[model samples]
Structures are given as structure tokens and as C-alpha cells.
Target: MKNTIAERIFDFLKDFPPFDVLTAEQLIIIARNVKVIYLPKDKFVFKIEEEIHDHFYVVKDGAIGIFRKEDQVLVDECDEGDIFGLRAMIRKGNYILSAKAIEESIVYSISSLLLEEIIQTNTEANKFLIASFATNTRNPYANDNKGTLFANVKSLQKNESSLTEVQSAQYSKNPITCQLKTSIQQAALIMSTKHVGSIVITENQKPIGIITDKDLRLHIATGRFSIDDPVESIMSSPVITYPENISVAEAQIAMLQHKITHLCITKDGTANSVLTGILSEHDIVAIRGNNPSALIKEVKRAKTAETLQHIRKKVQQLLQGYVEQHIPISYISKVISAINEAITQRAILLSLEEMNTPPPVKFSWLALGSQGRKEQLLITDQDNALVFENPPKEQFDVTKAYFLSLSEKVTQKLNTIGFEFCPADMMASNPRWCLSLDEWKNQFHSWITKPDKDKILLSMIFFDYEMIYGDKNLVDEMSESIFGSIGSYKIFLNFMGLNALKNPPPLSFFRQFLVEHSGEHKDQFDIKARAIMPLVDAARLLILSNNLKGFNSTIARYKKLAEVEPQNKDLYESCINAFRVLLRFRTQQGLKNNTSGRFIDLKSLSKADRLKLKGCFKPIKDIQELIKVRFSLSHML
Candidate 1:
């Protein structure tokens, strides 16, 4: 029962990941199930499309070269502690890559079933083993996969378990309120002072009407009505009411169906009942993070900017966990975007409170640049703008002033929360960027029509905007306006394609990493400029030229491109894989150095990591060539 050889395998695996993160008791369960085999140098472990072993392999000694069966060129070299054969376990697809021993090897073949049990919650292991071909390096213990990494991830497990959507959710006990007799000034004073988004207008402890931030902004702040008017005058009558014991799922569906944020909670489930509490999107967002639903819950309850800042840090940990667990890039983007947008929404509400007044006009907060693309992985400089519904000409200055004041507070709080201010002052607080819907539309048209280098550069960044919070209709119309402009002036796509080609393929003729030449980043590899941006630019331009909409993510764009242009599927697929690795590499560097992961120190990378980096460049080169051919840019070049 002792099995000395198996014990030795356990000892080695325990020192590495999913295993390292596991307990001795847990490792014992796994170590007992492993199958050890000897592989002499140049001998094959498994041939391509060979029947996959029920177990995955880990190297105990020597290195294994994983080769594409087609060309037989080694794609990755796995040394001690590296994993292989995981994809086969997951996909049961015939081995796409063959593994061979480059030197005499002692391999521990781990029972896939055993790993599934022992590290069931070990997302770190799941992330580590997500893609077998991804293992060019030694260990995958760097990030918390939060137990979502493996085949047993059970995508809906959290929903089935943690979210008892039928069970009554905890509602706010102390509901903020205003009486019908209350003046608009009194109501605004109450809302601003208490920092609530809405006030239930009640009579005889029964919900009668409601006034929200939106109501205040549209009806009074824009000079539509005087502050002296009774709150009832502008209140949305017959307040949407729910019972105090309503389920989280019910609350969400109701909010969506009614197109409302605040729902009045009553002693009974109907509008005729006595007001007991209020549920809002704020309440739903605060449902708790045992699941994704719970994660947003913490984001919702962040009372102070500092609290939201703290949540932002937690979001980073979650992000790192997702990356570590090898979650799909698309899913990761959606999760992070939810967290990010929630934070921005919370901050915006808080900012409104700080201003002692509601927004002067209906407005939306738009996240620009990378955030717009929803591809933001690491915290970077804030690129944002404010777009408001245009006010009457006489009230424009006062309206702009109110929004500018709110933006200043929000941006400062966001800065405190760790999103650094945009060095170029392209934030909502900047008058140049903050504009009426008409103004933003005109600015976008100018950028498209002019086609000058400065304007083109602006267009590249400004065009991919996504609304973080506020009015969705405003953003939709603005997007419509932008596409209309692009439709008429189609030459802009050519200009954009030209601009996207600014950063050439990331390798020299020698296949070396093309690093920066001088300035603050001398001798450093500018991964963002040379590697990441090229793909980002390519994806954006491709989508734009095709007149596609709603795909802001680079990975999504690439995935779509592969779908529409099936001829380029392999190329797009390769680009996606490469992009994932490069992005992960950048994040690792950024987390390690406490700086942006843009400038990588090539000397710091191991030979294996360097090889992996090189592997990712091929797709970049191929994509650029495609772009050049598609745009007919040989003459321009």
C-alpha cells in the first residue's frame, strides 16, 4: 500500500500546482491513483490522434516536446512539473499534438477522474489544465482559477446551489421616503443627503409614487420645473411595488420588465399594501459573491469610494483567478466588465450625492479605449467621456457646469479607487471630452471626415466607446450617428486600416522580439505597442470595414471574423490563442513589477517563456499580411 514510487510522484507533484495548493491528505488520494512510466530519449509518449489515456501526464524528470503532428515541429517543450494530455482528457479529441521524450523521462500519469475529485474546488488546477498545448512553461500555480478551471467546472453549479433565487433575498429594511406634500427642494435635499438613488412617495405608509435620479434629472434639473413644486407633481405614480419577501430572480425580472431601477417593497406583494422596503438594481447587485451574482453584490454595497476601491482590488484578485483557472477570454471579459461597470455605476451615484444635486440632464458615462472594447484585464488610465441630452440653449451653461462638477468628483473617486486619471485629460471631467449627444456626434463626424493624422488617431481610440452607466438610449443614438457617418464616408475605413498598420509585425527578420529603441523604455519589449495593439487595431479595423456592430472585444471580433471568413479560421484561431498568451504574460509582468505590463524585460523571460512569446508572433504577422492584402495597402506601404 505504501508504493514508494507513487509516494515519490506525490512528493514531486505536491511541490507544484493544483497539487501544491492542495492539502497533504488530498495529495495522498491523488498520489495513490497515479500511473508512472519511463520514456527514454526521443521515444514518443503518445502519437497525434492516438487513443488518449484516461489520465493526464506530468513530468517528474527530463523534458517532453509537444509537437504538431502535421509538421512534426515541436510547438512546446514541457519540463518537470509541466502538464500535458489534459485537452485529450477534456475533449477526448484525438491527440492534436504528439508528445515525445527529448531525454529519459519519469512521467506521472494522473488519473483524470482522481484529479476531478481531489481538486474539485481547486480552480487553480482547472486553470492549469485547461489547455494541454498551452503548457510551454513549468508550472501553472501562478493564479487562482477559483475552482472553475477543469471539465467539472459545472457552469451552472453556482446558480443551482448558491442562488436560491426562490428564497427571499435580504432587502433594505430602512426605506428612504418622501411624502406627496414634500417640496422638490425637500426631496432633493433628502436624496442628496442620504445618498439614495430614489425616494418612495408614500401616503399612510402605502407606496403612492416614486421619484428617482432619472426623474429629478429630466424633470427639474434641466429647468423643466421649479424646485418649489410638490414632489408629487413629477413623481411616477402607482409605484412598482413588491413584497419584502420577494426572491432575487423575481426582483431582477420585474426591474427589467418594468424598465425601472427602484421597486417599492410592501408588507404584501401588491401596490395596495403598506410600504415595507425598496429593492433596486442596487439591491440586486448586492446579492453576495459566492457566485457571480454574489460578486456583484459586494460591488453594490460599497458605500464609500474607498469601499469601491477596495472592491476593485478584490476584482483584480478575481481577474487573476480567472486567468489562472484558464477561463475562456470571452467569459472573463464579460465577468470583469460586469464588475467594472458596476463599480462605475456605484461611483457615479456617489458622485451625484457629493454634488448635492441630481444630474442636470439625462446623461451616460462612456468608457473609451480598451475599456470600451471590454478587453481591459489590468487597471489602466481612465479613458471616459460624459454625454448628456442637449438642454435648452438658455440652460446649456448651467447644465454643463453641473455635469462637469459631478464628473470631477466621479473621476477623483475613480482615481482614488485605482483607475488612474487619463494623462491626456480625456475623462468626463474634461470639457473637451464631455459633450451633449449632438456635440459628440459632430465631433465623431469631424474625426471621420477630416482624415488627418491627429483626427485619425483620435478616431482610433474614440470610436469604440461603451456606456458604463446612465441612459442607454443616448449611447445607442450616438452609435447610430457614428455608423451613419462611417457609411457615407467609407474612405475612413481605409484610413483606419492604414493607422492600424502603424505597428508592424512584432518580430524582426531574425525572428527576435522587436523591442523599443530608446526613451524611458529603452531595451524593453513594448508588448502593448508592438504586440497587443497590433491585434487590437487589426480586430477593430476588420470589424469596422465589415460594418459589424456589438463586437467590441478583440477576441470576439477575431472569433466573428473566423466565422464570417471561414477561409481565415485557422489564422484567426491562432491569433486568439497567441493573444491570450501575450495578454496573460503582460498581466503576470504587470502584477510582478507593479507597473503596466507594456514594457517587458526580455532578459527576465526563461528560454521556454521566450519560445512561447515567439510562438504568438506568427499569428500577428499573418493577420497584418491579411490586413494589407484586404485593404490593398501594398502601394500605400
Candidate 2:
């Protein structure tokens, strides 16, 4: 049996990753054979191209740097509970990079023979080995690029069909033709009846010209040509033509180069030949893909709740497509945001229609928390607030009741759609969150001026409020009030800045992750609170200090900061990149486990992923330093 020290180590490892997959007895067995090696700072464990060792290493304490000879770059750093030196073990090949202690560190070296024996029996452990050995061949968070994860590969494969077809282009098979002498009004009638955005103008069953929505708007609508004018008067002559066999990709490119959305498929591949069909961008999009915009339109036009549900299903398909394509998380965030916003707006519209009376005054719908920041991926509980215009004292109770009823109806529809009610009853349906504009302003004032820990927490949750629907003026007025309050209480930003530094990047006691010391989630890393939120809260606080409004998104704030401070441009850009990597990792993990990717089981992550994640924290440390110096927050700490 392993000693208490090794048993404790095994206990930590088992909760996190490959160790977690092993039986407790198996872990204790492996732990007994572990060589706990300590190294001084900057000591090399192994050099690049060195023969593979019989064992791999995991950071038990402190940080270890994995350096690549090429450019002498510090590829990644392995923190507490992070694995390293395993790729060589998996491949039985020489080490590709050198591993060195970045700081004073203790590493647990597990015998490869023992690992193999465990893997042969442990399916989960073996699968993890394969994953770690494959794509993680190089540091994903190297100086040059943020690494893509397993989820990226899955997302790429998923989006392949639509992306492939988009590159190839799909054309209509049925051609709507017209004689050259056909009156513009008649052609317009046919287009209207067919519900097509563009129509082909043909003569003798041959291609001639094209008339599109743009043409009609420019010529007929602008009085450049009369309704009775010959179709040739406004039709685009020598239309952009492609052969019938052109792929969707080729067709899309051809249309783009010609600056047109419609591509005519002709028999002889020329404008003079017989026209086979017209291809619209919309047709191409509908054939092989689902787009968020199309889904949004469907949501708006949906006649029934079921139809909206269908559109929501389409949104999921789009999300799957995006995730598979390895589309940037920011883009995915925006697309999801638009779809979520559309659903909420549609729900509100449906509720309004069901209501017996129009709202007495302008009221705005607010999306709180992650949804408000437009970062929600998987559906979570609804966090909403309502801000209605203040009414006379006599009508106050009545107005509040009316909005409460509306909130109840809206939240119910949202629940039906997907978003569950907030467990704490923090939703707009709650009396506290559903308030008048003046009341909200007062709330902000109280939170900022008389800030206590609870008030500060409340402010953090409430400050991220995004106006979803209703009068623009009301939202703008609310923002103005916030700025006015912040301007008077500059210390609010300092307090917020201090809050951002609360987690200290979770670097080890020796400049690495301070892994969970015990319990159910023991050794499982808390990546969210430690790595992501510090950056998020910092970005929000920093941006607010600049008096910026309506930019709650972390990336957008960094981009804005980069623009405003040219001297600190590189730092802001780095923060953006770091934030993206961490967010992407969290999302990928969340998707994999079907839970919030906040607490990461270290054993499950490949040696490379663990290192990449550790690499992301460097910028976090740097940025925290900047925040400290800038805000004079050292005293508070």
C-alpha cells in the first residue's frame, strides 16, 4: 500500500483525469511506484529529441515549462495537476520538446509500463491517452496561435456538409423565362406570383438578361423606366452565366466576383445560350445549410409557438454547424446571441398579442448575467429584469401589476421555449427585478454609493443588464443614469478592479494551478473562476471606467481598449486572445461533459491540453499586474 503522502497524491489525481477513470485501488498502486522528483527553477528535465523515458510526469507542485527548439519559444507550462512528457510515452518516440522546471517544482513520474498495464484495462484511460497523443503534438497556445481542441475537430466535421456545398453552389433547376419584348410589368407580375427575388430574361428559350429586386428598385421604382417599358429596358444585359454542372462553391465565387447574388445556368455557358435556371444566394443557403439570419426571420414570421420551436431547432443545427466548423467563439457567441435575442423578442411579441391592453408606457426587457453579456451557449436559467416608465403615484400599483402580468407571461413563454426560470427567482417575473426606470436608477445608485459585499455581488449581476426589447430611450436613459452614478463614485471602479483580482489567476503556489486540495471535485481544476471570470470582470470594470456603455462582451471591450490606448494596444490584444482561448476551452469542456465546463477534471485532459491551458494563464498574470498598477489596488490586496 502507498504511504499517506502518495495516497493523498493519488486521491488528488483520481478526481481530475486519467487517474479519475482508474479504480481507487489502481490509483493507489500507481501512486506507490511514483517517483516524486523535485527540481530547482530553470533545471531541464529532458531535452528535445532525447530518447523517450520509461515514465511520464505530472506537476505535483509548482510549474514546469515545455520549450520548443524552433525559435526557442516557451510552448506551454504545466501547472499543478497538469500532465506532461506523455506524448513520447504514447508514441514510443523521442521527446519533441524540452521540459524544464519554470519554478521550484515537484513532479510525480509514473512508470510507462504501469500506465500501459492500466490503459490496457481502463478504456477511459486509453481513450484519453489517444486524445492526448494525437492533436496535442504541438503547444496549441504557443506564441503564434491559440490551440483548437477535440471539440474543434468534431465541430469541423459537423460543419463540413454546409461549408462544402457553399463552396460548390446550388442552382435552381427550373428557369423562369421571358421574351425580350415582354413588358417589365408582366415580368414583375410573374416574379411576384413566383415569389422569387430575381427572374431570368430569356428569348427563344435562350439566356438574354436578368432582372433582380435591385433592378426593379433602381429602374422602375426610381422612374428611370416605366412599368410598361420592355423587360430589356431595365434587365441586366449579358448576365453572369455559369454552366449547369458548376458546383455550389464555384457558383458562389462566380456570383461574388461578378458582384451579383443571382447566377444563371445556361446550356452553352454564355448569356446568348438557352437558360437552364437562376441561382439565388438564398437558394444556395437553404439547400445545404441553415443560417442564423434565416432562422431569425422564421422566428419573427412564425404564426404559432410550434413554428418558433421548429426555428429554435434550426438554431441548434446552426450552433452545431458553427461548433463543428471551429468558427471563432466570438462569432459563435454573436450568432447565438442574435438567435436568443430573436426568440425573446418573438416571445414578447406573442405575449403582447395575447394581452388585452397595450402597455400604458414604454418598458424595456433586460437580459441579465451571461445572456446579457451575449455569452450563453447551452441554455441556462432565465435572468431577466423589466424597466417600465414611472407613472403617477395613484397609477403606480396598477402599472406595476400590469408589467408583472406581462413579465409572468413572457417568462412562461421563455420557459416553454427553453430558458428555465431562475432558481433564486431573480427573473423579471420577480417583484424585485421588475421595476420602474426611476426605481432601477435608484437601485444602481444604492449599489454603487453604499456598496457592501452583497450589494456588490448584486451590482455585478445587475450591472450586466442588456436591453432586449422596448423603448430605446428608456434603456439609454438607464445607461446615462449608470454613468452619472459611476462618475460620482469613482471608487466603484477601484472596488470592481479589486474584485477582478480576487482569484489571482489561480497560478500554483509555485506559479501553477492551486489544484483542489480535497472532496468530490478534488484535484479537478476550477478553470472558470480562476482563469476566465477574472478577465471577464476585469474587462467589464476597465471598460466601465472609460465611461463606455453597451459593450458588455469581453472581446469587444478588449478591442475597444486596444483602439483607445495605442500604447497598451499589444497588451489588450493579448488579453483578447487569452480570453478567447480560455472561453473556447471552457465551452468545449462543457459540451463534452454536458455540464458547465467550470471545474475541469485534470486527468481527463491530455498532457498537451493541460499545458495549453496553463499557457493561457501567463497573460492573466500580466494583465492582473497591469490592473494592479493602474488602479493602485496593491494597498487593498
Candidate 3:
């Protein structure tokens, strides 16, 4: 008797881990006895110390999160076709860990007795499960035998292992809820009995307000209220609530913004919704991984620009760790960029609060130059601008003044955050740079149409603009307008192409690095002017010529170029490698001297480092040659 449902299960299971090792006939036999279960988001499939089910489960859809109860660590996330619930069944003990649906899902459970019988005689299958059990988390669907079984092997002080500040905060599913009218005596008893510090006052299963020990201490212990009073009488109304899918960064930000210790987890992310769980601040720091994402956490709590500046200084340490860890420079850039962006966002939000009122029009803050490109590994001067929505003629001055004042505040905060004020006054605080959308469009038009040397120089600097805060749509429109201007004035690209080759790879006639001859620092290599800028210039030219949108970082632009021009894949890849090496080399130098790594003491470099630097220049030269031919710049050459 072939069951149709079992046959469908067999077809799906045969493609995933552990089961992939079994024969079709054996999988069908197992599937016939499989029990399918549905779990809503945030629902626990199995909880810590809970009795093990007879079967091990595999995700048929959505994701299952395996959390460590002891530390509240999101140890591993099981996605489609990933297996869970096996080890406990294998050990035949109460679950030491908890498995919950991170998303709504259908899970197929194969009976443990049948699974053991099926795999016992199969040596390879047994080895696979044992290895998975050992690792605690093997992505069996992946070609590599990587898993997270021993992820909990760290000591109690293992907060330095991996940063969980970005991972989801596993909330207490069973929150202590009491009616708003419940006597303070009853609520206090519940808190003592449950060993919890907070009690949520709910109305019709919805969180309305909350009472914590602090509220009790400040109100009751201080003789302000009696225990016999209603819980609502002293409760803080309108609770802070987050959805089930809050990340550690968001949770940290929310807590910092509200200055609260616990957040109610609700279904629809509102106080009016049904309460699902409670996320305590302790749950956040408990799973804080070794990753210096604590910088992001700290940035959230920053009250003044000085605090952000302090946090920015600590970011270098995180950068040093990533470099020491041999993490890819691209990934390092992303992490650093996220931190920088977060600091900027908090600064803007703080500035908004300081303003008399919010800006009258939508506006976006743009980070230009290195900060804009997100390649500013070392602390550098802030290069930013603002583009506000066009206002009616009568309201333009008032609106512009409000934004300029706001920009001034934000820029000052950013300066304190370690981004030095741009010497050229290119920041949003500069009235010349802070413009209406129409003004920015006109500005971009002039830059594209006219190729004067100063305009050309500024054009290149401005083209790498990335939105740091505000309405993203303005940035999109700005991009479309810039490209539109280029389409009309196609000759501008040639001038831009010429600029890309202005700083040739710094090699002397004899191939020695062309170090500075008579500058303030003689015999010093200009990594930025020579190596870094050439690749940056080439990426900008090639990507802009292709009219691609949104590829801002030099490395990202190169990767995109490689994808579009597969013929130059090796060249693009080499350029990417070279850029990373140069970027890191500069970063390490900057760290050592506490100055921008723009200049390198050539005499200090080793023979191998010299060779690596020399190797990077070839791609620089090759790319420039391509840019020259593409734009017909041989005559200028």
C-alpha cells in the first residue's frame, strides 16, 4: 500500500542531507512512517530539557533556529532540507538544546527507530550523522562537511568567540502576564515565584503596560504606592514592543532609544498586538559574540558626538582583529561600513531631536569621497553633502536654512566621531553643497557637461556618492539624472576616462616604485595617489561608462565589472586582490604611525612586500590601457 503523501515526502527528502545517502526504496519506507508537523514562527519545535520525540525532523520549508538555552545563543540555523531533532533521539535523553521555528514551516519527522534501522547497516550514513552530531551543526546539504555541533564547546566566558549582537535575541516564550486590574500584591507574588523581574499588564492578550522591580522599588518601596493597589495604577503605560524577527542590532538600538531593560515581543510589532515573548537586555549581552559588534551596540547608546568619537576609535581595534583574522578585505569593508553608517544614523537622529522641529522637506545626507565609497579604513575627513526635495520658491530659503542647520549639527557630530572636517568645505553644512533636488540636478548637469579641471576633479570625487541617511529615493533620482546628463554629453566620459589614467602606476623607468622625489617626505611611496587611486579611477570610469547603478565601493565595482565583462574576469580578479593588499598595507601603516597610510616608507618594506606591490601595478597598467583605448585617450597620452 503505497501512500501518496509518503511518496511526495520521499521525493523531497531524497534531495537533502542524511537521507540523501539512503536508497530510494529505503527512503520511501522511512517516509511512509514520517510524521509531518506545522509550526508557526517563534514556536518551539522542541525546548530545553523537554522529552525527546521518537523522530528526528528535517525542515521541508522555512528555517528552524537551534538555540543554546544556557547562553541564549543562536547556535545554528537550520534552513530548507536541514536536519534537526536527531541527536536527542539518538542519545535518548531530554533535549539539552531548544529548536524553534524562526519562520513558519512544514517539518518532516522520520521515526528514530526506522532511521536507526535504515542507517545502522550503512557505514557511510552512520559516519555522517556521527560527524554531524559531533559538530552539533552540519549543513548536510552543503558539499563541505561543515556543521556547528561543538559551537558550545567554549567556556562560560566565551563572549569573545563570535558576535551575537547581530543574531536574533531569543526571547522568553512564556512571559508573565497579568491583568491591568490585578492587585500589585498578586503581581509581586508572581514576579517572586517566577524568578522574573518584570510583569506585563495585558488587556485581551495584548501588552498594554509593564511593571518591573525598578517600578516597584521607586514607587512602592519608596512608599509611593501600596502593594494592594492595582498593577495598572503604578505600571508604565504603552510598553515597548518588537516583532518576533528583531535582530540583535535592532534590539540593541530599540533598547538604547527607549532606555529600557526589557522589550515585549509582539506578533505585529505593536503594543496593540498579541504578546508572543519577552526579550530582556540580559539576553542581548549574554550571546554577545567575540565580534566587536559591541561597537555597533555602543554606537546605539551614544548620547553625544564625543561618545560616537570614542566608539569610532575602538572600531580600529575591530579592523585590526579582522585583518589579523585574515578576513577578506571586501567583507571587512562591509562590516566597517555598517559601523560607520550606524554611527552616522545615530548622529543624524540625535541632531533631529536637537532641532526645534523636523525639516519641512525630505532630504538625504550623502557621504562623498572615501567615506562615500566605504573604503575609508583609516579615520579620514568627512566628505558629505545634502539633497533636499525641491520646495516652492517662497519656502525654499526657510527650508534650506533648516536643513543646513541640521546638517551643521550632524557634521559637527561626525567630526567628533573622527571624520575630520573636509578641508575644502564639501560637507552638507556648506551652503554650496546643500542644495534642493533641482539644484543638485543642475550641479550634476554642469559637472557632466563642462570638463574644466576643477569641475573634473570634483566630479570624480562626487560620483562615488552613497546615501548615509534620509530619503533614498532622492539619491536614486540623482543617479538617474547624472547618467542622463552623461547620455546627452557623451564626450564627458572621455574626459573622465582621461582622469582615470592621470596617476599612472608609480613605477620608475627601471621598475623601482616611483617614490616621492622632493615632497615633504622624500623616498616615500604614495599608495593612495599611485596604487589605490588608479584602481579606484579605473573602476569608476568603466562602471560609469557602462551606466551601471549602485555599485559604489571600488571592490564592488570591480566585481560587477568582472561579472559584466567575463573576458576581463582574471584581470578584474587580480585588480581586486591588488586593491585589498594595498588597502590593508595602507591600513596597517596608518595604524602603526597613527596617520593616513597614504605615504609608505619604501626602505621599511621587505623584498616580498616589494614584490607584492610591484605585482599589483600590472593590473593597474593593464586596466588603464583598456580605459585609454575605450575612450580614445591615446592622443592625450
Candidate 2 per-residue lDDT over residues 1-637, each given as its tens digit: 4468777777667645667678887888898889989999889889988898999988877677787653265656566666788887888889877999876889888999998998898887776777666444322211112232121221112235444432435667887778788899999999899888887877777777889889999998889889998998888888887767555545544554475778888875576777887888787667655655456667889766667767776766565544543445676787688789889999999988888999988899999888888888766789999999999989999999999999999999888776788888988889999999999999999999988888888888887888899988998898899899999999988888778888887776786567788987888898878888888887888888889887888888899988887888867876876787787777777666767778898787765577678777877888889899999999889
Residue 198 in candidate 1, Cα distance off native in Å: 29
Q: What TM-score goes with each of the models?
A: 0.61, 0.64, 0.59
185-299, model 3: which lDDT tens digit per residue?
Answer: 8999999999999999999999999999999999999999899999999998888888787766557556655768899999967888899999887777666532334677888
- Indicate the residue-level lDDT of 493 in model 1: 83
lDDT (Cα, 0-100) at 122 in candidate 3: 71
lDDT (Cα atoms) of all candidates against the true structure: 0.77, 0.77, 0.80
238, model 2: CA deviation in Å? 20
Better of 2 and 3 by TM-score: 2
Which pairs of residues clash in candidate 1, taking residues 3 or more apart in a chain or in different chains? Answer: 123-147, 127-325, 285-297, 286-297, 288-294, 289-294, 289-295
Per-residue alpha-carbon lDDT of candidate 1 for residues 321-372, written as tens digits (9 for 90 to 100): 4455444455566667777888888999888877777787899999998889
In model 1, what is the error at residue 83, expressed in angstroms? 3.6
The residue-level lDDT of candidate 1 at 16 comes to: 56
